[model samples]
Target chain A: MPELKTKLKEYRAIFDMKQGELAELVGVRRETIIRLEKGQYVPSLKLAMDIAAVFGTTVEELFSFE
Target chain B: MKKKNNYRNFHIITIIVVTVVMLLYFIGNIFPDNKWLTPVIIFVYLSSTTKLIGPYEKKDELTKINLGRANGITLITVIAALFVISLIGSNSDNKDIFASEVYIFTALAAILMRSLLFIVFDRTPESLGGDE
Candidate 1:
């Protein structure tokens, strides 16, 4: 099975953003952001788009299936 | 965040209230005569109190998904438990546990299980043990 890998933590670091701040920006719980960073949760298209937008990147840039 | 806190607090309060009421009923301190009345009162109280909490709490996508998962698991577990309890009750000559009590216990257990599972899912990161 292909796993969803994310560059969420790297992107957050580049933006100097905390998990809570990113979650607030993307309208999700901090835990959701944490899970995304760890590749434990597969986000919906809208949430993926929202997070990617927050980092000023495309979803394909932030997330990949491996 | 305030809305989220309120939603969580509301569920915690409901669990505590139900547990106490059920305990009192089981101990023969309240509703000793009318067994069905206890569940009816609990159901009415829960429904009425839910309206008081308002419907304004907007859950995020992850929270909503976790809740759905938790509810599904809780339902399955409760049904399985009830089946096992009935099977044992039918096999044994012990008549200590009444059907109404079993129903009340099952409802309480289901509520507790769903709430606890939601809390766990909401708070715990799934990859906590993984290499960071």
Candidate 2:
């Protein structure tokens, strides 16, 4: 099953947040953020929700199944 | 999010604590400084290493899969290690009581299985995880 990822800069640009800022808000390491952007680590449901909450969006809007 | 963060933080803390305690143990052993402190240091070392599950793995049952793959791997490795140890010791009449393998097969198996479990079964239910 392929999990659709957040677009490279969509959430970040929406919040005017840097990668490090997003990582800190989501309670993951900056390296995790880097890897996640490069399609390495798939964010967990909790992390997905947290990120969506940060940008005032829903999890469904942030991620999709491909 | 914070829960996951604490898991990573706890792992770092454990590594630091174990490293310091082990260093102290070696220093105590070599220097022969305090007879009172050596046993205490050894106890700390054992306690820290035995705490493999930590708080996160304990919560996620799949990571605690000693009943399946981990246990099988551990059992086979231990049997093999014991065989090798016995073979080596039996070669001579005088048995070396303190002989050991630092990275014994059992230890290797445990680490590998633990890491595999952590990566693949990290959040999945045990019903859908591991090898028996």
Candidate 3:
């Protein structure tokens, strides 16, 4: 199944955030940001919600399937 | 369901095979020349495989599946490696067993396979056999 990930770069651009800053915001390892951007892992529901909340968006808006 | 303890079978068969293998080695006077290592290789592989995988099988479900997968991968990798070595050695009159890829392959495969199995098993305090 193709998993559409959050446009992390876009989110970071809105927040004026660097990878390290975003990782800190999300309370995850910096490497996790790298993998998330690459679509290597589907973030857990809790993590998705957390990331979406950080960006002031719903998890549904942040993630989608093509 | 009563968890089966087939550990006894594992122990008995491995011990018997080891003893027989050792006896055969002693009887044959295995030396530097004209001494095929197939029997010895099989003996060590079987015994180690049993010892490493058996206890986990008795204890956990995931452990069994992981070990089987690791073993399957290792067996495939080893066969591939052996075939490669044979291919390379086909032209050479003198193949140095000491520098053979099989040794490195076996060591890497066994260590990774067992470590993956152990990680998958994810030992608990109870599994550690602590004082009850």
Candidate 3 runs further than 4 Å off: B1-108, B112-132
In the range B98-122, model 3's lDDT, one tens digit per residue, is: 3644565455545555455444433
TM-score of chain A of each: 0.97, 0.80, 0.85
C-alpha DockQ for predicted model 2: 0.04
Preferred candidate (DockQ higher): 1 or 3? 1
In the order shown, the candidates' Cα RMSDs to the true structure are: 4.7, 10.1, 14.3
For candidate 3, the docking band is incorrect
Which digits, one per residue and each the tens of the lDDT, describe model 1 over residues B16-66? 777766676677754557767667767866765576555534578888888
True contacts kept of each: 0.25, 0.00, 0.00
Which candidate comes out best when scored by DockQ? 1
In order of TM-score, best first, we have 1, 2, 3
Error of 3 at B81 (Å): 12
Q: Give the candidate number with the greatest TM-score.
A: 1
Candidate lDDT scores, in order, read 0.76, 0.54, 0.57
- How many angstroms is the interface RMSD of candidate 2? 13.1
